[model samples]
Target: MHDSSHHSVDPVLAVLRQYFGFEAFRGFQREVIDHLLAGQDAIALMPTGAGKSLCYQIPALLLPGMVVVISPLIALMQDQVAALWQNGIRAAFLNSTQSSQESAKVMQLARQGAIDLLYLAPERLLMEHSLTFLSQIPIVLFAIDEAHCVSQWGHDFRPEYLGLSVLSERFPTVPRLAVTATATALTRDDIIKYLKLQQAKLFIASFDRPNIHYTVVAKNDPKQQLKRFLDAEHLHDAGIVYCLSRKRVEEIAEWLVQNGRRALPYHAGLDKETRQRNQSQFLQEEGVIIVATIAFGMGIDKPDVRFVAHLDLPKSLEGYCQEIGRAGRDGLPANAFLTYGYEDVIKLRRLLINSQLTENLARSARQQLDTMLAYCETTNCRRQMLLRHFNEAYSHACGNCDNCRAPVSTWDGSIAAQKALSCVYRTGQRFGVEHLIDVLLGKKTERIIALEHMQLSTFGIGSDLDARQWRSVFRQLIAADLLVIEPVYGGLRLTERCRPVLRGEQAIRFRQDAKAPIAVKKDVQAKRGTLSVHHHSKELWQTLKKLRQDIARQQGVPAYCIFHDATLQELIDKRPITEQDLSKIYGIGSRKLKEYGADLLRIMKQFAPDGIDV
Candidate 1:
């Protein structure tokens, strides 16, 4: 076994090796499992790729009875159960997708004590029949997946989750494990309170996904920008492109397909069958891109997604983190690129203000929007800014994000900010950035000429910079919280926060993106070394991937289910010769070793004859 702990192979490590085919547990996995195995409740705040499921799944294997997982969506449940089933674990799910006959079969299996793990949607679990049925079974534990949904303040709150507190009321003795990939302290507290987890041990993993290079660009010709990024960096990789609306998802997916890229659209607006087909296609096929809305990627378990690009602004920092977390699951390098424009911000503002959200919720939503906007406009390390939002402290620059890689240059923009603020104020703050910029630059546009704005003292004052530079300045000012776009008028308005800078009481600096078009070099992962495959291992790696793909097709499962690209990379790097060596590979659990060990060994010897154990 791979030595996870320094001690000899203990029971947990033995289970890990026999089942998951690994030597050791990662980070807090062992700690969380130990706590749960000791019959204590726990909450794990792990990142997307940090193996949160294993924390509960491993414990479930060791426990006496079946583990019940409260998952959010049917697709997510199916993927997780399929992966477990591939690992030779008897896992099943109950969802709307199942007929009454199928559901009854699964329930009968549960009653007979046959299933190791059972996944259910929250609504299904809370049903009177469902709860009564569970009372008859030997339930070892309850694992609440995506526990953040229980928080009303969270990005993806579900009303169905609020009823989960009854689990404590009904099964007071059963251990409960609540897990989420993204949750702030507030959301975390809400989850603990709502779920009624009694003195639950808290395990918070680092929110950093170091392998994903974060980049935010100004939204210029959005579809073209998306196309260029995909073509340049992820032409042959699997990825997701997130849009704010169903229409945009369909249009972008169609555009990608028309351009010879195999892309599919996913949204709540699609028929159930179509959505399931698109999601399955995305997960089961390699190099397939899914153009989707926010509704698509909450609990997807695919591990080799190469990138996630956003065509518009996300409503909250939590939402942004959760969406981008979908990439780089197997620890191979991935990329997250976000494109935001002035209209995106305005649209979000309108959504928050005009929606039926309560007063406090609206305020919180606005605050979240400001934080996300600041993230988009930051001149420092994107990773640092992102971690700080989650209350995780990173003392130095990450050196992995686009800002740290390119090192943005800055110039004194106090005068420019004051001039911009004055232009907005003198122009009555009722006009948007275009009219304001035209007036500032003394343009002879129809609106400017018709409004007679050329007569103001601030008119023609911003001649030192071009219109594009002024636009950047305005964008930065808004990001800095010095200005806000009114929801009703969609016009520029100065906030009280802008007073100090406008009055020359404080100095402001702006990033000069003229050096690079706000878009960094597309080869972010190659530079990071995580995605940089060695030349000697390249051929073998490709061969392993081909074999895994073929096996996946044969099994009717996603290629990552057979083996993730990261796992394949390790196979090439290690060049394992014997069954024992194969058993030491991270993702090669005992079941997989027995199933494909001979084929893998044959392939290894065929490609790397000199390294074989003859």
Candidate 2:
């Protein structure tokens, strides 16, 4: 048995307890921190909101000298630095957003040993001068946030990240930590290889986020459907609306704003200030809606976003999960609203086929999309299907999603699934979903006759089911493992496991496809009203948030990056009077107390003298 007492209290844990006020680590934080503190390189695959930042943040504080965090997006870096400052940690970031004098001041602080953490964009770090300057600092730890971007095959790839291996080579003695929320097995291997962290410890956290409800609506009159989704049940909830194109983002943002919703547009085409301003407003204000393209939402740290609605199908499951993971970071219930249609799949496939990546990468991307499509189309428990994709076992059906809460009537689809599988085998497994659908529905058009699929015995076997029913059967068959899609061959194929069912030796079951859930209308008056202010000490929370934001802005960072909602809630619950009392609150550290300890105390003094002041 392991000796629990021998596990010495990590210096970082002390900082965590002193500054953040948390008594223990969450998820893989303890093990990951231990590995890094031991001076080892490591790669962490954690789901969003799993405290991946803490794995590095704690080490940065505990280890003597500075930690250089290489990140891709300037917005993300700003947010992270702001969050560090809120905990009273001295943190600075060098990115494109800063002027020359500002950059010089930050660098000077690093050289003078005044800063504990410094955030750098990968592109900025690639500069010769920056690297030379970085070498001078007593670098304790090097962290690569969003490490998956190093992989060319990843959904979000940055060529600059490829050269980050030099950091390990130049500072061979310094520990390195790389973290990302999404990575397939392939992406994981690529990150390890590209970053040259072969000997690094690996931590893979459970991918399940049970608080987010998953639902997919069939794409028919999507605009009307979206309107129904935004109605009163979700009113007053901050959410993101993802669009496929810049034009759609603008149009949707305009529509929502015109309808009196606090909405804004965000896309690559928008000016940097506008995008930054919109994102900041959304983060600070309640019930703000951000309509954006895929270009938005990387490294965003919003915790209370109530839902993430997709106006268009995402390119891959990795992208989808990362996007939706932004919601409910505070562990409250959230929704993932997806609208799917045949055209979306076709467009996604065409985009994948057109990409310059190798056939293998393209195939893998396509397979991921297919899996997402299966989840969207599945009539099974939404949570179970999502969990199963990540190799997790989830037995009970989640009753919160659209399907389970309002279940659709399902008929026995054993015969339909059998016919769909039969078509794949009879066609030599060379046909895709469309062709197979034709064969089952007895549609002997030119292409059908040209392929001589008319000769298949299963051609008319599924004639009883209409085109929609047959399509549903094919979808269900793939989900049940009775059928598999061959991405390389660009078609569907029957698996060996399908034999028993074909021969009637085994039974096949399927949930008849449920009709799309009806959209509920929102009460306009309710949506336009302000968030109900309920506070035992309303003035105290406001004062806390104001001081937090002022300090964050001066530090050139995002507000929440300083302190999470939970930590702020704690301040309201028990106002800390002394540094010791503050240390007892979750997420407070000595470094943070040294920085913001006085400010917190002053705020409490302004309210109640006998009340504890930080």
Candidate 3:
């Protein structure tokens, strides 16, 4: 709960309430800001929607000199700077997209102490000219965004991040703050070590996002499945559909549009202009879907994404978590659906094996894949499994996942596991899932005959089940650590864990895949019971959004930069009549209240003449 106090009374709380329109700091925001204000280095491991940006944004306002933020993505910097400008903060970004004059003007402002926060990419900051210019400025502090990129163990590792240590070398006295939304224990250690934040205070917020309901299903007719999920669960809502390849992204985008949905394609393969335009549309327009490869959503700040769907398996759980974390950023109910098949596993394994990664890095990547597969196959609780990967423990089940909603049927899979292990061992463990399944199904194919695997003692011994069932059994074996894929040759091999199951000393239970839901329900609603104006105030909400969209277009900013859906929800709830009444609503900062107060009040009066109190 917020403190419910006006900002003109207290300085720190005033900055929060006046600009950001929040009455209080969430999680470790105040602690981290206090540490930074005391001239101490810190590291914050907050979840995506946990207000990581505010931890630094608020401090920059209180600190004396300009705060230099090392951001990774250009789009991220643009979004952050724009949001800051909307808050009436003096923020600027120096990026490759800016013209020479624009860049010089921004730096001149920073040099003149006119900018409170300045964002620069790591690559640009490490340049000789930029460093020379930065050396001349009075930098109060340095912030490293997406600090996990400094570690090889991180999913989005970038070599340029290694040069960020120069900040500590060049400006040894200035406090440094490193922030990341997703970092494992190893990644955290790597970030501290690599960024040289030896004495930094570590702040880790709870990784749980209770509003996001996770659902992982077996991929059967993936395109149709995604369409059904979208049509049934999230009609006319903004969401992101992630595909593994650019072709798939374009195909999905086109398919969605053909099916009477508004969608756009975004990926690295698209022309830069097209990609930027599509991304802008996704950010600016309401209920526009963006079908993209993983490259599209590094630092997207859109808060009303109602869903994030994955048509293929991610390479690791970290990537999966980071991607799914994009939804429900507004603390509203959202959905994350992932559809995976055995083919996804095999394809990912082959890609990892054929990559140019060093041995250690490759091994770490394979381990991550194994963890992701375990997560996809787990039937206990999806949120629990996800949190446990980050060393967070949960004793009870989260009722929001598919498992808790509809329990899966489990069977004593020891005998089936033994048959799978025997097939791997007897076939010399050199074949992939296709040939292994063929052998298990007693199919007399040319490859099977060529390998002469037919004469093996375990051959055709377990023909009771079909190939699909065998595939499921083998997938569970891999998930359970009884079998592993040999990275070098991309073949299945038995692990030490297989010995117990094969010896009948251990019993294993495996979940059969849940039947896909024919049609999921649309479940996203703001404020639950408090939002009783669903039918009555529907027109009012649409009118408010249209007004916001028109103003955003005039200002050339994203619609959310004008007002968030949560803020609009407040307007619908309060039915404010006068300027003072509008100013009291949540997210209506003083600056916004003064600038658009009359217009908003008029809209409210038009909608709720009888309900207006003033």
Candidate 4:
């Protein structure tokens, strides 16, 4: 029914409609593609799910030679190449997963100009032989994904990325484009500087993902809190649970499995086989949860991740944004769940202090951490705070985040602040929150008694408050910069900012820790049986998904690679029962029709009316 190739006047639009089965470009996709086509360099600073791939993908089809995509992760490359191949585009990836013979074969295909897109890791592409071989080929363009990795201050910095500038020297005529989803101003500058994109045009899209609902809860009891979150929102849904440590990842995975979930643990600590298997399972199977540390989710391109739950604080907002951006990439409704506390901050700070990073880099890391803390402590819109980190202005409160949905209540805490600061000052300014809370609550702990802190004037002054309440106070104080966590002993120290509060000239108001929010919108679907499909259409949806899974299994590719959930939903809505009908649907280009048209048509025939002709 739909012949997008020959009918369109514009060649780029025709390729997009014929191969990708889309009507038009989204966000800055069209501009970036056109710029690259004109042999101009560009930097696209878009959030995840903003159709970053299409910026390079379309150009690869229109350009003379194959586009060499220097990606960071094997999984990312595999997912992209699979999707492209399924669309009938000649795409291949050369990474660690491939043997020497396979790599040579793919490179041979490139040498003959038989491929449209070639994907590989930066390290692989930067190899001397690899570079020499590539230099001999006619490369159309160089597209670098996750470009923020070039910066030492970036959340997931890879030292190897600093070498990417060689592309400019080697491929002088080829247009180069660098794309990153998470980069603060500093990181953005670093990406530009390191990638040598000085004269490149910049495209910065809004960092807001309107489809994802953001919820951050103060960590009261993380285990139970996570259980409650999963049960209440994303139970039986495909999601990721991020922890700060590998041991915690294993524990959470085991705990989730024990509570009746198909959960897996992923971290660098796991054997390569185990990590690959778990990651493959998460991509191929529906309703699977991955519990991993920051090591797990760099270039994961899963489009239907229903939610991303963080059991611990991510080191920086850049890391936090990129991690949560994994969810809702398909543009359907999804959720982000985070549970954090002051203990996470102390732990992360200690980790940094123990590292051998330079003092300047360490200071940058601490500032990034402080910004992350501000996001958690902010009473304003969470989305606003998140975008602010990227220097993007989202002036209005996005109603999707937890704060806008259910505003938090705050109380004037000037007296509590004075007591907390005084306790820190009197108790030798070097004690951690626990011992200081002990003195304030007048707990006769052995250490407190040994230090003779009970005699201090600040002792017993905060007895009216419980330990939990006092902990919250101190946490807020640290967040407010009235106190700082000293790196050496992980103890609390008063800042000059605390002087005004101590003098009663400045009043501090701390947010009353709210309970885990019970936010359920019928419009935002996180789990199956919750998506708003009509009763009759629900059966068709399940049938379509089953067909996709079956085909994906036979092909040994991810089901989403075969057909995204959005594409299948469109199929159900259109009820295409013929090649013509199917081609008219989005994501069903001429190639996809040839590959999957008959299978889809046969499936929809089951739902056809009894009296209607087949």
Candidate 2, residues 431-480, lDDT tens digits: the string is 78878778877887899889887887988777787877666667666656
Mark the 10 consecutive residues where model 3 has the least summed lDDT.
Answer: 522-531
TM-score per candidate: 0.95, 0.78, 0.92, 0.94
Clashing pairs in 1: 2-23, 4-24, 21-589
lDDT score for residue 4 of model 3: 58
- Stretches of candidate 4 off by over 4 Å are 1-8, 519-530, 608-614
Candidate achieving the largest TM-score: 1
The reply for model 1, stretches above 4 Å from the true place, is 1-9, 515-530, 534-536, 609-613
RMSD of each: 2.8, 6.5, 3.5, 3.1
> Residue 1 of model 1: what lDDT?
62
lDDT of 3 by residue, 1-614 (tens): 87757534767788998887787888889999989999999999998888898888888898788998999988778878887888889999999999999999998998899999999999999999999999999888898998999988876889999999998898899999999988898899999898999899999989999988888888889988898888766877899999988889989999999999999999888898899899999998889999988887877899999899999999988998899889978887788999988678777888887889999989888888888988888888989999998889987999878888777789888888888899899888887887888887788899989988888877787688777788788778877888877755668989887898889999999888655753443343333222234787889988999999999999888998888888898899878787767767877888788778888988887887564465
Sorted by lDDT, highest first, which candidate order results? 1, 4, 3, 2
- lDDT tens string, model 1, 410-484? 999999999999999999988898888888888878887787887899889999999889889888988888888
Q: Residues 218-292, candidate 4, lDDT per residue (tens digit)?
A: 888888888887877776789999998889999999999999999999999999989999999999999999999
Better of 1 and 2 by lDDT: 1
Tell me the spans in candidate 3 whose CA falls farther than 4 Å from its real position: 1-8, 424-466, 486-491, 518-533, 609-614
What's model 2's TM-score? Answer: 0.78
The TM-score obtained by model 4 is 0.94
